[model samples]
Target: MTTASGGWTVIQHRYDGSVGFYRNLSEYTDGFGNVGTEFWLGLSYIKEIADKGNTTIRMEVSAADGSSAYEEWPEFRLGDAPTYTLHVGGRGIGTAGDSVRYFEQGNNGSDFTATGSYCGDIQHGAWWHNSYCTYINLNGEYATPGTRSRYDNGWGGMVYFSFKDKSSLKMSTIMIRRND
Candidate 1:
């Protein structure tokens, strides 16, 4: 987290499979895991922060070899519950290629779906899916590098698609900072 700009809250972070991310809607809504470790800060909390004022989102992904990439969106806002929809604006700038904003027209307005999950194709995990799927499924299952092949064809792992064409991830972190 860039300490230079304070108030940057970590919305999600995962470095290992210690905490299961394949959870239900309730778990996603209420949040899970440890803030000091693998955790998702919860949609409710994310909404509250977004509602307060303008915000920016940053996503960083790394491979087992320590190679990493990051993406940043200048504008971000999450909707309220029931739908808990997502709205990410502006062209993301980073090494991750703005994958979230390039999934079939865009996943910008996709709803936060947890049922069946992973775009209803497989049980990768809950995420802000655009019906079919979102390119960036950071909340997907945690598949070790050795266990990636078996799940590659189905995107069954914590992955940032555009990074390596469904490449398995070793670590990832998402943070949001308010502009006002």
Candidate 2:
């Protein structure tokens, strides 16, 4: 929340393995962990605040090698319950490519998938996911910079392939602010 734009609210943030991201459906809906550390600010709450007004989302990630990247969207908001579907407007610009909103066959809305299933299990966490996952995954198992596997199955950790093809990121944070 220390940006020049100011009034930024952290929706999710992870730096260390202090908090687990591989949580169940209820846990994701209700949320868990301490915001001061690693945490997901919950589902319903996210929808409530986002729907209140026009919002912009910023996703920042850092690699083990000290490299970092980010992608921002001019508009962002989640859908109603049962599935907090993600709706990312369009890509702004940043070092990291715009992968949040897949506008081809994938459309733009993606339902928030519960962890421990499909790509969530293989990728290690949950979020608004598409059939082809891994565009961006901040809510994944935390791992040290170099203490992880380089295989596909071993990719159950933080991933932002656009960031130098790094499957296991060192740090990541997602924050939102009302554009109004």
Candidate 3:
């Protein structure tokens, strides 16, 4: 069977000298009836291995359709390397057929306009953008930017940053609507 959009696999390491594995293969419907999938894989060293207390574990992953971006928030510390790489080459699709279009205003405080921002494709993935909105350009368009958007695909994933005249600005975002 084909994996769902958000299927996941998980592996666990218990106190015993054995390992456990689990996979979440089916999609789920939220309160709004929208369907989504999720999968994860984790490993645990046997009690003998963890007792050492200084061993480090390494991990590698390959995924698409925003699967690779899902992760738990790591604690804030020095020298953290949370990285993501996407291998996509083509003009992504939009809600209105193959055209790209979207509008954004109040970006960076200055009034600017951009085109080619309507990208909501599922196969080619969608645009994902996170910016330091200084001037707040209320009108901007992103064309094949490869950065996910909240307007499409319910939650095309994204990371954002903001500042308020030197002081830290707390960013606020809403989740995608759950429905067909």
Candidate 4:
């Protein structure tokens, strides 16, 4: 779903443990002849609702498989607001060597900056690996990923958001399009 402003495409997912969703960009063959998506945008939100002691929300991404390229953003308690916004985009879509960026903000007056520049890997499948946000739970243990699972595979040219925890989360908006 998309917000009224049409700036962002909203997505909501409740997490019982480690979970993720992704949007594929394109298809390409890796240097080793492994065929997979050339570029992908994976968004994962980690939070424990019941445990107020754990007040950190982590957002992470997996891109350029086998290149050890990844991005993560963590936000602390901003306020009591339950809504959050994640803005992701790049200069060009389907363009080789284009850079991708991510930003986030919470209703509690918390803001997160975009991570460093990351380019899609054409040689290796830019698949979503086991990338997750940092979870800091003081009272309970956080979830973790055991293997690589494509939650939203074949969803290219789109945006996806996954939420994992006891509480239900809502996405107000999601914007995916050309920046210029």
Candidate 5:
């Protein structure tokens, strides 16, 4: 499933992590002139091992031209029930560089609580160009250059999930969404 808004698109995917250490759940293309993109994911029916603190999950995004960025979450205990919701995305709100945030929520009885939150600048990575806006000639069509628009370089990207101890986990749901 997929949804779009103001030039950004999000797709949902289903994944089963019964036998691997890493799983690439979904991938997306942000066209050719988007400022930033966001992804939200949910995992259910989790089966964790006795040593849960070593298990990990990750989300990665890359430009169609090869530029990329990624963020990973910390380990959890077996008794935590394993279900989780994660959010990863970039925002063009700061002057230094594009601001990025990664957040995680773990299931607890009838509710979920924030487990992790991280912030960074997209310019720190070599995959992305520091210029917030740039002109591009697309199939003979000309586009204006500048950050006046929120999305200027709608590059392609992907989302992935990884586990440290594969034998202990069996995920049932891999709900994913993209937001601008």
Candidate 6:
């Protein structure tokens, strides 16, 4: 792995799409021969509804950045719907209007950062309800149906929700590409 001067480390290896960890990149294992530290495509989990029109997928991760923390979740796959508990914690935690945005991946492995909208506080579980879902906009803003929602409490940053109840709807169909 080569670290860029800006701090983004680029890891080079084959990603078999199995299960493993990477530095500053998505977790993946290219094959069995290359173990940890080598470039390998570990696993790629994806969910899609066969007979549905709107494809909305919700993924549960370690709440940490980079691929290493992502590998912490066992049996990870794409499209497999799972309920999650949302919390906020980070350097960008508290401040008026600051928040963490959630986004779905595109076909190319890019974050599509511009498309992400703010869902809740980036620091931890600050803005959320037991059974509430919010929509996002291109500017990373959280909103209800039509109007704009405000994160007034600078102390709370914002609110976010997760799969608190197991009985909720099936999140999405996951397609596990590879498992190392």
Model 2, C-alpha of 93: deviation from truth (Å)? 1.9
**Tens digits of per-residue lDDT for model 3, 1-180:** 122232222211111112111111111000111112121121121112323332222111112222221111111011111111111112322221212111122211121111222221221121222232222111112112233333333232222112111111112111111111
* Model 4 backbone overlap count: 10
TM-scores for all predictions:
0.89, 0.88, 0.17, 0.21, 0.24, 0.18
How does candidate 1 score on lDDT? 0.76
Cα distance off (Å), candidate 4, residue 163? 22
Q: Candidate 4 — what's its lDDT?
A: 0.21
RMSD of each: 2.4, 2.5, 19.3, 18.0, 18.0, 17.1
lDDT score, candidate 5: 0.21
Could you tell me how far off, in angstroms, the CA of residue 47 lies in candidate 5 after the best superposition?
Answer: 4.4
Superposed Cα deviation of residue 68, candidate 1 (Å): 0.4
- Best-to-worst order by TM-score is 1, 2, 5, 4, 6, 3
| Top candidate (lDDT) | 1
lDDT against the true structure, each candidate: 0.76, 0.74, 0.19, 0.21, 0.21, 0.21
Q: What digit string (tens of lDDT, one per residue) describes model 2 on residues 74-160?
A: 678888887887887766667686554342125257788866668777777886778876556677678776445333454666777
Question: Which candidate has the highest TM-score of all?
Answer: 1
- Judged by lDDT relative to the true structure, which candidate is superior, 1 or 6? 1
User: For candidate 5, lDDT tens digit of each residue in 54-83?
Assistant: 433333332223333334333422233222
Candidate 3: list runs displaced more than 4 Å: 2-81, 93-98, 101-127, 132-180
Total clashing pairs for each candidate: 0, 0, 39, 10, 12, 51
Off by over 4 Å in 6: 1-45, 48-71, 78-130, 133-177
* Backbone clashes counted, model 6: 51
User: Across residues 1-180, which tens digit of lDDT does each residue of candidate 4 receive?
Assistant: 232223322122222323222112211111111112222122222112212332222222222222111122222322221322222222212211113321222112322111120211211112222122212111111123222222222111111222222211221111232112
**Stretches > 4 Å off in candidate 1:** 1-6, 103-105, 118-123, 146-154
Q: Over all chains combined, what TM-score does candidate 2 have? A: 0.88
